[model samples]
Target: MSALLRAEGVGKAYTLRGKRVDILRDVDLAVRGGEVTALVGHSGSGKTTLLHILGLLTPPDSGRVFVADTDTSGLADGALADLRRTRLGFVFQSYNLLPQHSALRNVVLPYTGRGADGERHARALLDRVGLAERAHHLPSELSGGEQQRVALARALINDPPVVLADEPTGNLDTRSEETLLGLFRELADEGRAVLLVTHNPAVSEAADRVHRLDAGALVAEGSAA
Candidate 1:
C-alpha cells in the first residue's frame, strides 16, 4: 500500500527576538499504513512541530504535506478542516479531554453529526480501549492512564487512517506507557498509519520503525521488521 501521510521538503521557521530560527528544513517523511513510526528527538528539536504539520494543524513555511496522496498545500482552510475531521486523528501529550464531559461524551463529540448511533460507536471504542467501565466518569474522576485511554478512544472514534500523537506518554508511569504503546501497535497491525513523537527509548523499541530528528532533518534508525 502507498503511504497514508507524506511530507516532502518541509521546512518551518520562527522569529525569536531578532533572529530567524529554523525548526525544520527539507524534512521528508512517509508514514505508511500498517506500521507504527516513532519520531525521537531532544527538546526544541521540532518533533511536535513536524507532527502538527503532518496533521495539518500548522502550515509549514515551505514544502508540501500529502494525505492519502492529496497535496494539502493548495487546500483552502475549510477544505483542510474537512480533511482533518474526516481523515486524521490526533492525540496530545495532555489528555485534552473536556473537564465537564464524561468519557463517553468526549468520545462522541467528534461524531456529533452521526445521529443517535454515535453513542453506541463511542461505547464500543471505550470497550476497545479497555475503558468501558469508565465511560461515564469525568476526567477528574479517572486516573491519568484512564484519562489517556479515553483520549485514545476518542481519537479512534472516527476510524481515521492516520493517527498522530505528540508525547502521548509524557505524563504516564511505566505501566501506563506500556499499555498505551500496546494500543498504538495494535492500531498499526490493523492497517492504520500511526506516528508518535516521543523521547522515550521504550516507545522507539515498541515501534515498527524509528526516525530520529536532529538539526531540522529526519534520519531512519534501525531496520523495519
Candidate 2:
C-alpha cells in the first residue's frame, strides 16, 4: 500500500533578526497506514514545525508533501483547507477546546457548517475515548486528562486517514498518558497513520517507529524495541 503521508527533502525556514533560521532541512519522512510514528525532540528542535507542515497547516519552503496519494504542493489555499478539514486530524497539548462548549460540542465543532453527522459521530468518538459520561461537561469542569480525551474524540470525529498529535499527553498524569497511548495504538491498528510528537519515553515505546530530530534534521529512525 502507498504511504498515507510522505514528505521528501522538506525544508522550512524563517527570518529572525534579519537572519535566516532553518527549522527543518532536507527531511524525508513517510507514515504508512497501520503505523504509529513518534517524533521525539527537545524544544526548538522543529518537531512542531514539521507536524504543521505535514498537516498542511503550514507550507514548507521546499519539499513535496503527499497525502493519501495527492500532492499538496500545488493546491490552492481553499483546496488545501478543504483537504485538511476532511482528511487530517490533530491533537494538541493545549487541548484548544472552547471553555464554554460542552465536550460533545467541542468534538462536533469540526463537522459543523459542513452538513455532516457532527453530533452523532462526535458522540461515538467520545464513547470510544471513554468520555461518554463527560460529554455534557465543559472544558473547565473536566480534569486535564478528561480534556485531552475530549480532544482525542474531537480529532477522530472526522474519521481522517491520518492523525497528528503534538505533545498530546504533555500535561496528563501517568495513567492518562497510558490511556491516550492505548487509543493511538488502536487507531494505528485500524489502519490509520498516527504521527505523534512527544518527549515522553513511554509514548516513544508505544510507536511502531520512533524518529529523532536534531538541529533541523532527522538524525535517527528506529523501532521502539
TM-score, every prediction: 0.96, 0.96
TM match of model 1 to true structure: 0.96
The local lDDT score (0 to 100) that residue 166 gets in candidate 1 is 90
- Model 2 worst lDDT window (10 residues): 111-120
Evaluate model 2: give its lDDT: 0.92
Candidate 2, residues 1-225, lDDT tens digits: the string is 458998999999999999999999999999889999999989999999999999999999999899988999989999998888878999999999999999999999888345656788888899999989999999999999999999988888778889999999999999999999999999999999999999999999999999999989999998988
* Candidate 1: C-alpha lDDT: 0.90
Per-candidate count of clashing residue pairs (backbone under 3 Å) = 0, 0
